[model samples]
Target: MNKVFNTRYLVHLVLAGLFSFLVFNLTYAVRPSDYDLKEGDTTSASGSDDPDVYIINEHGYKRLFLNPVIFNFYGHLGGFAKVKAISPSTRDAFITSGLFRNCEANDEKVYGLESTGEDTSILHWINTTGAQAVIDDPNFFKKVFCINNNEFNWYLKGSDYNSVNQIPVYSRDTTSTSTVRVGIIEFVPQNVVYGDVHYAYLKKTSGCWLSSGGEIGNYYWVSGSNQSIHSSDCYDILETYSFLDIFNNLSKGISKNVQRTIYGEEDTMETLHSVYYIKDFYEKEALKYGVSDLAIDIDVKGPYMLASDPPLGGRWGVGEGVCNASLTEFFVNEAISRGVDESQYDVIAYVYLGDWQLSGRSYEGFTSCATGSKSFMTVTTWRLPQEDEGVVTLAHELGHSFGASDYYTSPCPQNPTLWSCVKDPEGIPEPNKIPKYPQTKGCLMAQIIAYNKPGSDEAGDATSISNLNQAVICDATAREFGWR
Candidate 1:
């Protein structure tokens, strides 16, 4: 087989649409002798096949992976084969940059080492956070640079830090759009791997293959004839996960488990593509809420609608579909039957655009984001006739799972997390009663109508969903998630 064709084919298999959905790491034969290095590659000195590996970063420098766990933390384990055998000359060609890069997957802050030329480098708080942070963005600025647990504790105790113990502050100014200069250190986007990038390690070994159902199928891919017959047996296991967990811990960056199944569509690839799409949207939602580091596990159930294409038809409301409670009853039963953990995961079930129509007017879905103690209200229709539109709708419902009340709901007694809603287009939410704000977002939970009404929100733009990364996390929601 032509390597180029294989590469292009597989690359097209995923990257044809979902960029953020898939990391898209494909490899061919390696000519280890030359310094034909790629960004995101980790290499070592040519001696004993595998010694130490350094992540090849930008600007003629490679940051060493100090330990095994740290390397795996960046998901290098998935590409262990990509570790290059570099000669001593190739090793010396790159200057050593820094030591460790550390951040929790659920954390927005990324920490890097500031060097003193000695082996020791002072740790500086990185202003950037979440999955979308570039390797390094030049424009990142902060008065409270890194908001790691340590700094967070300082604020917790209400204590003041002396100048000596304080971590060096960096002005997030860049000489160029391509390079980020914080305080004394300068680097480009390529200089660092800012956020957690996961590489899934899956291989067809001379062994059994797990079926889409997770059981070992009758077919085997170990031998030539077996490969021919068993190729499609476990193809269902080839899933694309994420996140919108590929970024929304749904809203406030906690935890989410998503299971997607295909319906009204025959193409198997649609499921994979939809997974990426959902993950991508949710991740954007997560980034909007500043929880891209949140661990969202994805489970892809193969081509079948749950409980027979849910009859998600009728007017939308909190309790039920048609001004009754049966609407909520239907989805809640399905959720319980599927063993959905209401406390942990928020689940949404959707149908093809016209599948659940009632009249000239399409049927709507029941929603309950933060209504009393209701844990799940699955369906969300309206503004979801198209595929992309449906994803945003489902994500909106999922946000309820994160405990974000719809901005269209209450007015008085106010939501303390966001800016005062007195100027709200929908209605005025009272001023936030929270004592102080460390970080805040555009109150994105506001309904579309709120932003589109004939007035400006003195609070901020609440409906900038199209403007990615234009949102942030508010203080109370951040406090609820324990980020404060």
Candidate 2:
């Protein structure tokens, strides 16, 4: 309240005695089809005198990012590709909505912008004592507007918090993961619907994460009963069931972005196995990868797999006591000892102790339980510190682990009706050296997939593999797992 107001350049107005606000009614018609800029992506008018960047919201609306401080506010949302330049025509394709960037240095006050028209909006100060924040959906913040002290003079003065038509803020369990919520929303098309992408208010106790509204719950969104709602209905229908008590209530398994449930894997402690050597590094890098995974259905769950010491002992790095072959041998031996069901579509993840060369490796297929690997994956920290990230390298390796039996076998890919590593002594000359998986032609990173390798180009790798969450499963591999 002590801060000086910058009302010299702007007029102070209080309308209707309850609300005062700004109007940014852009008249540009939208094609929707012309929108290539997506949510979480920031774009500005190409070569403008005064470049104003906007992050696309879920409904394809563009909200003013305000300034650098506001843009950095949601950096927990992971990344922005340096404010891409879009044509002025392309930029106008989306309607400009109210601002959602936070203006307060503290959580003392927050504002919500309710759209009365395609352009007109009214601001309301959230001042309710028990008014729980609508963080169940991150995108909800996109539609709302946030104002600073200077702009505060130009707006509504009363605490008119409308309870109905409520919004869902991005929610997460403060226990299981350190991921934060953001106002980012992907601009999903209107014609299509999505069952994926959900958020839930969760808590953890006694080593189990509990969610009253998620995939297995009766909630409208996570249960797939009404994903068509798209985080609407004000979330009143959600968080309805509270069973934080009773031994039988806690969720058995939980995948993330809120809910990517993976049950029956008691030992899938994805982060713990890599904590020894990469502990400090893993803690920092893993979060970005985890948040990034929220965009894709495949969220980063873990480096939770077999390693040299693992739970049985201490930490070890690649080429320390295990090379590619020896590591596979160790993993196979562990699987044998653990009676690991190879048919269960199981994968063992190995990580770098401190740092190691050969950044990534994964067994393509199972030959025999005793002879070949149990489809284990290894992600080293070698080249990660240079440019690529450790979790990203792990994602690439995990993609290979999720690959189908057809990748390394005699059967040709159904989509292209062809195969790589062609058996032509006349061309490759050393066709025999090319593994049956045609690994030399790339794709199957059976033992190792390194940046140091001479050639590392595959369609899936080029498009989606390295990204934590970008697209669904790609070609040269089954879109679905073999167990499915």
lDDT: which candidate is best? 1
Best by TM-score: 1
TM-score of each: 0.32, 0.23
Kindly list the per-residue Cα lDDT of model 1 for residues 352-375, writing each as its tens digit: 222233223233334433222232
Candidate 1, residue 450: lDDT = 33
Tell me the number of clashing residue pairs for each predicted model: 10, 9
Please give the distance, in angstroms, between residue 225's alpha carbon in candidate 1 and its true position after superposition: 47
lDDT of 1 at 291: 27
lDDT of 1 at 36: 81
lDDT by residue for model 2 over 214-237, one digit each (tens)? 333222212222333334322333
TM-score of 2: 0.23
| Residue 92's lDDT in candidate 2 | 46
